[model samples]
Target: MKITFTLDTIDKAAEEILSQCQYKTLLFYGEMGAGKTTLIKSLTKALGITQTTGSPTFGIVNIYEGNGETIHHFDMYRLKKEEEAFDIGFEEYLTSPYWNFIEWPEKVSSLLPTNTTKINLKILDHTTRLCTIDNGSNELK
Candidate 1:
């Protein structure tokens, strides 16, 4: 599914994304300042998370709990190599039955599961963005 949204409509965009996703793992792809983290914050809220959420850039990952579900958010932008993911037990997290939201997933592309969903965001202006979600199908649906 594809959506065009502004900060004012981000919540609705997040809900639409959740409804269209086919897997628990979501890989976010976007350039710097493209609103990846902003969208994630909206998504976490949609998933019933009441706490504030932010990019895990320095921490690598952040674990959030809400609505009887555990969410693992990862930021791979700082990794010098993909092997670094192993050092963090990323594989173990991937195998879990919880939700996973990964930023800079291209850094660990080979490790991603085939069933994962990919959300690509593009900045259209200062406050507008175009979001294209693909269900790991190569072609956007």
Candidate 2:
């Protein structure tokens, strides 16, 4: 699925993505200031998470729970190597039956699962963003 949206319509974009998603793990790919974290926040809210969300740059991962669901949000930008992900029990998290939204997923690409969903975001302008979704098939849907 492809979507062009702005901050004003982010929630709807998030909803559309979730409705089309086929997996619980979402790998977010984008550059700095591309609104990856911003979109994840909207996603979590759409998933019924009531708590505030933010990037876990320093902490690596943040777990949120609400509406009978658990979400693990990961920020892998600060990781120096794939080993760092293992040190934080990243593999265990991936096996869980909860949602996993990862930012900077390229930082730990080798460690990512094969069945995950990928979301690519591009900044078209200061307020507009173009989002492309790929379900690990090497082709955008």
Candidate 3:
């Protein structure tokens, strides 16, 4: 599925789309200033999450308590090597029940799940974005 939006409507559109796909590992792909974090925030909010969430660039990972599950938000931009990801137990986090939203996943490309839902965000203009969802997903309640 592909969706286009301006920055102002991206959040709402993301929320609706994410709600249709429940409890799936989400990969956010985009360049700098592409509104990846903003989309994650919208997803969390749409999933009944009330806690605040920000980029995990510095902390590496931030956990949020949703209604009954954990939201593991990760930033691998600072990761230096594959060993570093293992040192931080990336596998454990990925396999866990927590809803993991990863940023800069290219740093640890080998570990990303093949069946993952990839959210590719492209910058059209300063405020416009093109998001493509190509995860073989079916509509869900």
Candidate 4:
């Protein structure tokens, strides 16, 4: 599903994304300042996460608890190579039942599951942004 929303309506947009996304593993794609973390904050809130959400840019991954489940949020931007993922046990996380939210997934593209959900964000203006959420099949339904 695709949505165009402003900051004021971001909560609603987050709800729409949750309704459309079918996978627990999600890949977020966008350029810097495109609101990837902003949208994720809304999404985690929708999932019942109560703590303050922050980007995992430095730590690589941050774990959040919500709805009696664990969410693994990853930022692979700083990794010099895909092998760094394995150094950090990326495979173990991928095989777990918890929700996985990956930013800059292209950095570990070779290791991503085929069924992952892909969310693309585009900055249209200072206040408006467009999002397209699709299953990794390359078909947006």
Candidate 5:
């Protein structure tokens, strides 16, 4: 699935993601300032999470509480090696039942689960973005 939208229509983009995504372990790929965090905030809102969401650039990971579930947001940009991911119990989190949204996933590509859903976001001029979704053979929910 591919979607192009402006910041003004981010909500609709988020809804399209929720409807088409096939897995909970989502790997977000984008350059800095490409609105990865912005899209994530909308996704959390769509999932019924009321709290404010932010990038976990420094903390590595941020946990958010939804109605009856948990959302694990990860920022691997600061990681220098895959071992850094394991040091933070990355495998444990990958096996969890909660939703996992990862940014800069290329930093930990080797550690990504086989069923990971890859979302690539590209800036298409200011205020506009093109998001391409690849579920990797996983069945859509």
Candidate 6:
């Protein structure tokens, strides 16, 4: 689905994404400075995650604990090899109940589930972002 929103309305759109998204795990695809981190931070706040959420580019994955299912914010922007993720049991996280938000998912397409929701982000301006989420449909190809 594709939609347009004002720059300041990112949080609102994020909430809508959380509510309407069929899959708990979302893969964010975009180039550098595409607002992937911003989208995910908004999603975490919508989920009531109070802790500071930053890019997991260096640490690989950042985990946030919640009363219900936890949130796994993963950034593969700095990933040099897929084996680094594999060594950290990334596969286990994929199958877990916690909601996962992955940035730079193109780096691990082979490991991602077929049902994984793919979000494509494009920077329309410094404040505006155009996003489209693919629901694992052949139409995406």
TM-score, prediction 4: 0.94
Error of 2 at 19 (Å): 0.6
**Where in model 1 is the C-alpha error above 4 Å?**
137-141
lDDT of each: 0.92, 0.92, 0.79, 0.89, 0.89, 0.82
- How would you encode candidate 4's per-residue C-alpha lDDT over 4-107 as one tens digit per residue? 99989999999999888888898999999999999889889988999888999999999999679788999999999999999879999999999899999989
Question: Which pairs clash (backbone N, Cα, C closer than 3 Å) in model 3?
Answer: none
What shift in Å separates residue 138 of candidate 3 from its native position after superposition? 18
- Evaluate model 3: give its lDDT: 0.79
Report the lDDT tens digits of candidate 6 across residue range 1-141.
785555589889988777768888898987898888988888898898888889888888999876565998899877787777897789999999879899888777778877777788888887778888778742234
Q: What does candidate 2's lDDT look like per residue over 58-87, in tens digits?
A: 999999999998999999999888789998
Query: 67 in model 6: Cα distance from truth in Å?
Result: 4.0
Instruction: List the candidates' TM-scores in order.
Output: 0.95, 0.96, 0.88, 0.94, 0.94, 0.92
Q: Which residue ranges in model 5 land beyond 4 Å of their true spot?
A: 137-141
What's model 6's TM-score? 0.92
Residue 118 deviation, candidate 1, in Å? 0.5
Candidate 1: residue 65 Cα off by (Å): 0.2
Q: Which runs of model 3 end up more than 4 angstroms from their true locations?
A: 19-23, 136-141
Q: lDDT-based ranking, best first? A: 1, 2, 4, 5, 6, 3
Better of 2 and 3 by lDDT: 2
* Candidate 6: regions farther than 4 A off: 137-140
